[model samples]
Target: MITQKAKYALRALTALADADADEPVMISDIAAQQKIPKKFLEQILLDLKHHGIVVSRRGKQGGYLLLKPAHTITFGEILRIVDGPIAPLPCLSITAYRRCDDCDGEQNCQIRHVFAKVADATRKVLFSTTIADAAQPTHSAEVTRLLA
Candidate 1:
């Protein structure tokens, strides 16, 4: 399962996506609107800014905005940024692959085989779905179909 931090990051990104493209959103506004804690959101946004996913403004009218288009930012990208690898098992992770300590060989590991398929399917959906998609009202049906 994705961590709460990941969930909050997704929600925050969607909120940003829903805002005016040229306008910046204050952290307090996002925290209140999305029900995320202000302190936690500050940390999350700082991380996102460091990753180049978002950019911040300064001064009176200053705030935060997406550095890239919402459609170009995939859910998988955010999850990987906030939660690390998306795989269910270390052996199945594409970005952070490591052999299981107890496993003798990947070729003969039944668990790895099953989870590899799961990881592939999960990656397909997550990488294909974007922050813009999540902001849409009809995205649920499309996401469900992708999983199906």
Candidate 2:
């Protein structure tokens, strides 16, 4: 399962995507609109800024905005940035692979075999879906159809 931080990050990004194309959104506005805590949002936005996913502006009209187009920012990218590897098991991780301590060999590990498929399917959906998609009103219906 994705962490709360990851969820918040996605919600925050979706809010940004829904905003005016050239306008930066204030953290307080996002926090209130998305029901995320202001302090936690500050930290999340800072992390996103470091990852180059977002940029912050300064001054009376300053806040935050997506550095790249919303469509270019995938859900998988945000999850990885906020929650680290997307793999269910470390052995299945593409970016941070590590053998399970109790596993003798990956070739014979049934758990790894099953989780590999899970990881692959999860990655496919996450990487294909973007902040632009999530910001749409029909997103939930599309997701339901995909899951069904």
Candidate 3:
């Protein structure tokens, strides 16, 4: 499951991607536009910066911007930053792979097999999606908010 933190991270990144590349956007602006809580967003932004996905400027007009182009920032990267492993079972995870404590056999674990497929499907969507993709008109807040 995607945590609230991951969702907020994606939301903030999408807002930043919508801005002009030459301009740095204020954190307050992103929070207001995304309706994200300021305190929570600060931490989320900090994590993004630490992961090299975002860079921050400290001054009167300083705020944040993507370290790379929006198209280079994948949803998988954002989710991994905020949500940890993509796979429900650690055994199915690529980076964090470890056998579940209760599971004894790798070849006979039905639950693990099911989750492997789930993880693959999830990875397919998230890895393929980029911050630029999230900024598309079809994904605009006016449309998303209405659907919500």
Candidate 4:
């Protein structure tokens, strides 16, 4: 299940991605548009900025903008940033791995073996589908594009 924070992060990113890349969007604007709490969004955006996912500017017309292109930012990357490892189990994690206390041998663990395949498939799909894809316009344009 996706956490509310991670959902906010994805929605916020999609909102920003849908806007002009050259301009930054204010947190309040994003919050109102995405129906997210302003305070919660502030913290999330700050974390994203720290991770180089987004950048902020200050002055009269200041706000946040993507540090990289939407197409370059994957769902997996955002999820990993806001949440943690994509693996279902800690033992199956590549980036945040730790030996499962119940397991005698990692390679010999049947549970691990099954989940490893599931994790791999999930990771592949998440990593390939970018924020740009998620932010794609809906309605007739989306329908035509899908048909094409």
Clashing pairs in 2: none
lDDT of 3 by residue, 5-93 (tens): 99999999998888877678898899999999999999999989999999998888788988989889888988888988788888888
User: On a 0 to 100 scale, what is the lDDT of residue 57 in model 3?
Assistant: 86
Kindly list the per-residue Cα lDDT of model 2 for residues 1-148, writing each as its tens digit: 9899999999999999999979989999999999999999999999999999999999999999999999899999999999999999989999999988898999999989998998988898899888988898778677556555
The TM-score obtained by model 4 is: 0.90
Count clashing residue pairs in model 1.
Answer: 0
TM-score of each: 0.96, 0.96, 0.90, 0.90
Model 1, runs deviating above 4 Å:
none
Our model 3 lands, by Cα RMSD against the true structure, at 3.7
Give me the overall lDDT of model 1: 0.93
Provide the lowest-lDDT 10-residue window in model 1. 138-147
**CA RMSD of each candidate after superposition:** 1.1, 1.1, 3.7, 3.6
> Which lDDT value does model 3 have at 66?
88
Computed on alpha carbons, the lDDT of every model, listed in order, comes to 0.93, 0.93, 0.85, 0.88
Runs of candidate 3 exceeding 4 Å displacement: 138-148
